[model samples]
Target: MERDRISLTVPTHTDSPAQQVVQYAQNKDPPSRPLQNRLRKTLFIAMPPKKRQSDVVRRKSRQSDVQPGDPIPNRGKRRYRPGTVALREIRRYQNGTDLLLRRLPFSRLVREIAESVRPRGEAMRWQSQAIQALQEAAEAFLVHLFEDTNLCAIHAKRVTIMQKDIQLARRIRGVWGGLG
Candidate 1:
């Protein structure tokens, strides 16, 4: 197994103020060679291993008694908020056994569908279509399920100063003009 490795190293030469300004102007994106490399490696490891020419992950169906709409948890995050729940659901649809994958993001969902029925050509074709449908459903669920609600709700909270200024303003209809 490959171990995690990140080498944080400062540049050998320090840039003077003028050089720093020039470098900043010339390059809008800062260099993070080490960080980027680490990220790429991390993603590679995070995803399931690639087997043969194709990578497939299939979960056998449960007993006839198991109900739909329930999902196995594979959130990989703090599942305290709705956004986190949505994220976990997305991860499930993208990667595991869940009825919600019925909704999903198109391309990613399709790739997964391809993997599901890969062994049988005809079945694979149908699975592809199913995947597309599932992805759309999953994407929809992620978007609406996490928004305009408790978890991802963004309501503006105004700070009001309850000083005499507010009381006086309410009491007076008069403006800054000559007193009426």
Candidate 2:
């Protein structure tokens, strides 16, 4: 029976005598069948050699046109500075009233809540003026609650408002129940 063999060849560029000796020994004794199989598997899966960082060439971007000390031109959307209103926000403020709550939906919700609480035989109806007043009060209450919740989160050195922060805010405001 003819046995299958695999040979390992070392690079000729190796100048060291020790490397040459090792190469000769490797060539003299071919790898066993299992070792040859492992080598074949590894060869198939082996990744290509990575290029050194020093050898890599970076292409110049448009910013290269500017001198070393000069500022690079802003190419895209400009960011709003602190306390500066965006153009869209300014347009929105001009186009609509500054009220956060929409009257129609809020009034509907208020009427629904009142109807749910009233006795079955009794009817509940809200005046336009009363609904407007309720909407304003609800908006103010919500804004204050959110501000307090945000402050609580800030106090805890966190940027995100959590359920605990809201509960703490409600506790401070003397409100009884939260989402819990």
Candidate 3:
């Protein structure tokens, strides 16, 4: 019995490269679905199933069950009227009635300075009212100095208050000569 042998060689083409490319492209199988649809199908298969609304567990708190018209149950802590203290303090500060610096530190600093400047062998004592008055005065002076410095900075077309701005402010106020 004689067996027939088939040739497994690529056929030689006399066609141009562009024509061959077109022929090769035409011979290739087209996608059944769009690229986006294929990707969506693959992602859907890879993703876990989503929980339904009934399947999801929700926390039920006392606050959540309360209606808008109902009064809030007190937890034994004192609660102030909203914005009362904050707004009052802001207004006091704006009107130059409130002290900006902390009381304890300012009083300590004033005491130390007073002690250092006092005559040797002399004892110095300050009343609470005197210390409070001193702190208020110092804070007011500082606020005024800061305002002047800020003006100097603004004049120099800068937002930041630099040492130069402070120096300029002090010079303008005639206080630069004695301090330096």
Q: State the TM-score for model 1.
A: 0.19
Query: CA lDDT, every prediction?
Result: 0.46, 0.66, 0.66
Q: Alpha carbon lDDT of residue 34, candidate 1?
A: 51
Whole-model lDDT for model 2 versus the true structure? 0.66
Q: Which residue runs of candidate 2 sit more than 4 Å off their true CA positions?
A: 1-97, 176-180
Candidates in order, TM-scores: namely: 0.19, 0.45, 0.46
| Residue pairs clashing, model 3 | none
The 10 consecutive residues of candidate 1 with the worst lDDT sum are 36-45
Tell me, what's the RMSD of every candidate?
30.1, 15.7, 16.3
Question: lDDT of candidate 3 vs native?
Answer: 0.66
User: Which order, best to worst by TM-score?
Assistant: 3, 2, 1
For candidate 1, write residues 6-37 as lDDT tens digits. 33332324455456445645654545555423
